[model samples]
Target: MESDEIVRKFYDETVDDEWERLERHRVEFELTKRYLNRYIKPGDKVLDLGGGPGRYSLYLAELGCDVTLADLSEKNIEFALKKANEQGLAIKRLQVDARELSTIEDSQFDYVLCMGPMYHLKSEEDRAKTIRECLKKLKPNGIMFVAFISSYSFVWDYLIRNPELILDSERKSELNKIVDGKDFAGKGFSDNFYISPENVLPFFNQFDLEKLHLLNSESFLYLREPELLRQKPEVINAWLDLAEQVCEREDLLSMAEHIMYIGKKPIKT
Candidate 1:
């Protein structure tokens, strides 16, 4: 199936339940809240770019931040609105694509988040434009948190799980048809872009970078033997703490499944 189709199917089948499950997890939800709260102050205007089903938008609104949830899919917008209404949370939801978000006023948001776009946009120009758009919307020194998939996922999925695609790609890179340029064996879904650490630094360097952090939300601890990790929450927490401590080091961040970058827009001279 095509990448877009895969996303549509995945969201259609799982987004609702996934949102509820992820939201209910106190540890994960609190961690996400802490991350967002770092950039948000009370009454600040915020935008959730590519905000699927308004998870982060709702969270931000609960924290007294005014939030606009922008996404491309009408279904997602409807879902977000329904959830917001049911919860009595006020979030402005818009069906807008990240690559073309000009309808929003310039320098209007204190914080702009583009968490879902970097992994799906295949073209370099489109990806960079999304970043530029985020930068354009932020007030000077406004914080933006963006997420991307890492290159190390390829080794985990392809070499470890499915070797055929990796072996084929080894023979010829073009024939690889690897998903998002990461996992050769990631035939389950289509259209992924796995960015290397080398590419990520320069990509954010295009803006005035403030801080870069790695989040192993779906890798490392989560991917470890579930039973073992769950049996020893303290052990898991200890490992996670250690991971975060060293994640900024060059070798560790490259292996993360998702990286959260905290960047600031430069003030005009």
Candidate 2:
């Protein structure tokens, strides 16, 4: 599946108009909010790359930040525009490829979020370009929030769930192929690269890593028994507290579904 098609399917089947509002109250939303709060402040100029349904962008706008919501899907842009208009909030929407970001001005935003682009980019060069363009758009000392699929999730998803597939050497061997700098599972559009926590630092070193926070966005909650976990509010809160501690530890960071890196652009010469 091409990434665009996958994203279309995602919106069509997995999400609806209420996705934006509902997702904000989820456990992962709380984690993202706490981490992102460190970078964003009132009156900041913010750009949300791949702003699906404009949830985070809307939050930023409400916080008094001037926000630009950019995505590759026209449908998403239209949806965002409709919602923005309804709230009487001023938000700029643009349809853009994450790899080619010429539409946005350089050094113009105080904060840039390259959230979903990295996951769908099947090529390291494309990933690098996405990061570089994000860097170019940031003012000196600007912050960027990036998300990546973590490798450990694949181990659990592929190795644990379907052991028979991995047990067959021929079948498992085929899974290791890397094409155009993307792993076999990452070959298709919807399937993007999953990097280990160890690989992240070197990749970000090409720019500058100001703060790195690994987020177990969907993992902890999804792993638990739904009924029991949902009924006990204290357990969920404790789980989050533990997850936060886990994110800070070197060994456990890779166990996350997605890891976020909050990076900085150097002071311009």
Candidate 3:
């Protein structure tokens, strides 16, 4: 399905403008930043693999982390550079595919953030390669963060918001495949794949990584559109707190639109 080209076109065309506008996306950014803050210290080296438009890269750099942002789209990389310059931050920007990071040295970064690549690599092998590349760049005992789209959330969204789109038998079949941890590459919906907690956890277990946390990036909060738009500041804070409290419940993780896996490389014995 030429998934690489599809991913390139999708991000190059819309990622910069589309994500920041959503309330869900705002929550994702804030939560991710908060989580990263707990692990990153001043002068630490961070590799932001597949970081779209350097949003996190710039934030990390501002916090005194030496950051390098790598993305598949040249357009994204260029935009990130301009953004870094405007903020008076120094960040290394590179255009490279996640599956192949030969230019990056092994065990070089104190932390690796693969925030956007896992969902786009449609095949299991490619997804594994991307993970290995990210781990290869992490120093022993360094932390890594990976994000994925949730199949349960995708199915729930269709049932609640877009049932009409899946009324067709073919579309319904594709949805079933997605639930089974398979992606429909030529479906023309979005190019990215989806994963369930069952499939994701086992995949990471194959690596020499110590599990830290599996969090729902945007939990039930994303489903509550009316409350998100109309609630008072205090109410919103309470909702966010609730979301964080339940983000790690395995029974509820699949309900999140996006899931995050935080792990660390084991130090060599």
Which prediction has the highest lDDT against the true structure? 3
Model 2 CA deviation exceeding 4 Å by range? 1-25, 158-189, 208-222, 225-229, 232-235
Each prediction's whole-model lDDT (CA)? 0.68, 0.71, 0.82
Cα error, candidate 2, residue 209 (Å): 4.5
**Cα lDDT of model 3 by residue, 1-269, tens digit:** 47788888877897667436444456677677778988999899999999988888989999999999999988888888898899999999888999999999999999999988876777888999999999899999999999987776657678767888687887687677654664333343457677766777888978999999999887666676455748787876777777777778887876787889999999998
Q: Where is model 1 more than 4 Å wrong at Cα?
A: 1-14, 17-32, 158-188, 208-220, 228-240
Candidate 1, residues 1-269: lDDT per residue as tens digits?
76556665565566677467554433434444557765578799999997777788887887788999987666777888888889888999777768887898899999998887776777778888888888889998788888776666555556445567645745335334333443222332346666765567677666665764545444344335344346576875666555445545665564565666667776777
CA deviation > 4 Å runs, candidate 3: 18-24, 178-189
Instruction: Count backbone clashes in candidate 3.
Output: 0
Q: Candidate 3, clashing residue pairs?
A: none
Using Cα atoms with residue i matched to residue i, what is each candidate's TM-score against the true structure? 0.78, 0.80, 0.90
**Count of backbone clashes, every candidate in sequence:** 2, 1, 0
lDDT tens digits, residues 85-168, model 2? 898888998888888889889999999988778777767888899998898889988889898877555555565458677677
Per-residue lDDT value at 238 in model 1: 65
Q: Global CA lDDT of candidate 1, please?
A: 0.68
